[model samples]
Target: MTNLGKWTARLAVIVILVLAFVAMLWWDPRPHFERVRQDHVVHFVVFYALMLSLVLSLPKLPVWAIAISLFALSVLLEFVQPYFGRECSLSDILTNLITVAVATFPIWIGKTIRPSDN
Candidate 1:
């Protein structure tokens, strides 16, 4: 594929992932589950998936921009949760950061090891 095609495909994937995340947040079905123990695991999985998606989608994006965007999105979701009968928590924000860091660590290491273009 050409560079343009590859980028377009990547952008499409990113958009789809973002839409899925929004849907999940908007239609949380945790209350229907009988087991509280499982809810925590589900939440962690979903947030981690979002973090991973962000890491994979924003390779060319500036690191600070990516971090700021993730933080803002997390905060927005947390704040919006109240209307959906969910409580916002700092721990969730921290977890999202951790997950993003974990997902991007390998990319960071790879860049560091590669020879500079200059």
Candidate 2:
């Protein structure tokens, strides 16, 4: 695929994933509450996908910027969960950070081992 086409497709996926994340976090809960383990898994998987998508879409952008921006967004979402009648907890934030760290670790390692020319 051409670079433009690839970028467009990646951006579309990122948008869809982000919308799903917001909807899952902000929308009313289902009739049955999810188990704690299930909830953590959901957070981990979604955030991991989000972090990876972001890195792929904006490869030129510094990894730290992407990680920090996503972490901030996660924290903001957690804070707003209570207003949506959902429980807000620190574990969710920690899960998000761990996801960010894991997803971005390779980029960090690559940059360290092979310093950028620019």
Best by TM-score: 2
lDDT of 2 by residue, 1-118 (tens): 6889887868876785876587468433532355666676777778877777776777788899999999999999989988988777898899999989988898688767853554
Per-candidate RMSD vs. true structure?
4.9, 5.0
Which runs in model 1 stand beyond 4 Å of their true positions?
Answer: 1-28, 31-40, 115-118
Clash count for each candidate, listed in order shown:
0, 0
Q: What's the lDDT for candidate 1?
A: 0.64
**lDDT of the candidates, in the order given:** 0.64, 0.78
**Candidate topping lDDT:** 2
| Cα misplacement distance, residue 56 of candidate 2 (Å) | 0.8
User: In candidate 1, what are the lDDT values of residues 5-95, reduced to their tens digit?
Assistant: 7788678667757665664665446444454434444555565566556555655766556656776887898889889888776766776
lDDT of 2: 0.78
